[model samples]
Target: MFKKKYLALVLLPLLLLLLAISFLGQAGATTSSKSSAPLAAGVQDIVDRGVLRVGVKQDLPNFGYRDPENMQYTGMEIEIAKKVAAELGVKIEFTPVTAQTRGALLDNGQLDMVIATFTITDERKELYNFTTPYYTDAVGFLVRKDSKIASNWEALDGMTIGVTQGSIQWGLLEEIAAEKGIHFNFRELGSNSEVVVALAARRVDAFSIDQSILSAFLGKSNQLLDIQYKPSEYGIVTKKSNTELANYLDQLVQNWNKDGSLQTIYNKFGLTPVTEISD
Candidate 1:
């Protein structure tokens, strides 16, 4: 009877130990899977797919645009996308997107990366990861060449301004004017092209967009009032879940800046890269 009791005590502790070990093993597995998920799933998918699908703009000139002559995509942003794909040893498939769809497409995995003048904002960072800024552009106006308004932000008071819908420029004028007591009427269009058209058709007094894009309309409209109201840095973006790829791409961008590859691309596109990796 004593032997039976001693055996029961020893085996009870051993069984409890076994059960604890089992629980701990399962917990460790769950942690490992959760922690390494992005690397294992998101990064692997890029490699298995053998192609990087990037969302870029089709209308913004000097950045991403379709060459009207040959209908081929070409610009500073396109070149940057190409360089990333080349480094990844993968083919690039460009998907044209507007300001409204760029974030959604990237988040949904319909597009692997986005380089369509994507600005990094804290709000957007919650949805995706962005590389170090490639350029720091500013918002500028495309106004009628003969307009009497001064070429500065102070001139925007009581003006009818046009902006692209879902663009970063939304609320920017009002936000900046918060301290200046400036107020203006807004005409929100669906796209940058539409905003330019609105400016030309006299539907809006001035069109607001990035200075890089405004440069393309210099022949038809006067560039005025470079505004830094909102962040204007352009960045390469990937899914928030795609941390590994974002890290890898950031390294590539840093190396490109160090080696002057970025300078060459900017010079080719007639753009002055205002920001750098160091900044």
Candidate 2:
């Protein structure tokens, strides 16, 4: 009976040790599983699909533009999109979008996000998620060098100013007009190129848009007015239901802003973003 009792004691400790070891192994596995789990649904979806579909502007140089000669997209926003895709370990597919088409594409589930020069506003915040501003710029006017218009906003008071259709510039101009108690005519076109064409054809007295964008179109024939107004901030846009993706993008932007990555991109493109304009 003593021998049996001794055997039981030894086996008991052995069984307990095995049980403890098994439990510890399971706990470690649980931690590993949790740590290796997939990302949020929105982000995981992009990864599973193997491609990040980003909407970017093809017309605006330096910010986002497609080279017809080489059939390639190049710009600051394009670089940003490439970085995002690399983070997700996916290839990037660029879809050319304008101010009018970007929102609709996002709503229709055709684009994962838009990196175009989309300005953030409270009203728009209700409709879609916007990351923190990546770039800021103020409104300016581009006019023919030979035009009699002075190098001031007030000079175009009564003249027709061409603006991109569906852009906020029209409303902004109206606000400025009201504040100054001056009336101005506006011609809304579909794209920046069209507005520039209108200005070249004298269909509009001035091409009014963001100064950063105007800098791309400046040449010997046209000059940007020495005025600025209503500084607007551009942000990455995602669908309203994809706050997870927006949050991720926001964090990336915050990091880039702090680490001077964005500044490096601006310098490569010779872009000087205007954060504020003096009255």
Predicted candidate 1 versus true structure: per-residue lDDT over 152-208, tens digit per residue: 567878889898878767576777668788888998988877877888888899887
lDDT of 2 by residue, 116-225 (tens): 98989998999999998998888888999999688765677799989988788888889999998888899999888899999999999998888878888889899987
**Residue 37 C-alpha lDDT in model 1:** 45
Supply every candidate's count of residue pairs whose N, Cα or C atoms clash at under 3 angstroms. 0, 0
Query: What is the alpha-carbon lDDT of model 2 when measured against the actual structure?
Result: 0.90
Off by over 4 Å in 2: 1-37
User: Highest lDDT, which number?
Assistant: 2
What's the lDDT for all of these models? 0.81, 0.90
**What TM-score does prediction 1 earn?**
0.79
Q: Model 1: runs farther than 4 Å from truth?
A: 1-41, 226-231, 275-279
Q: Which pairs clash inside model 1?
A: none
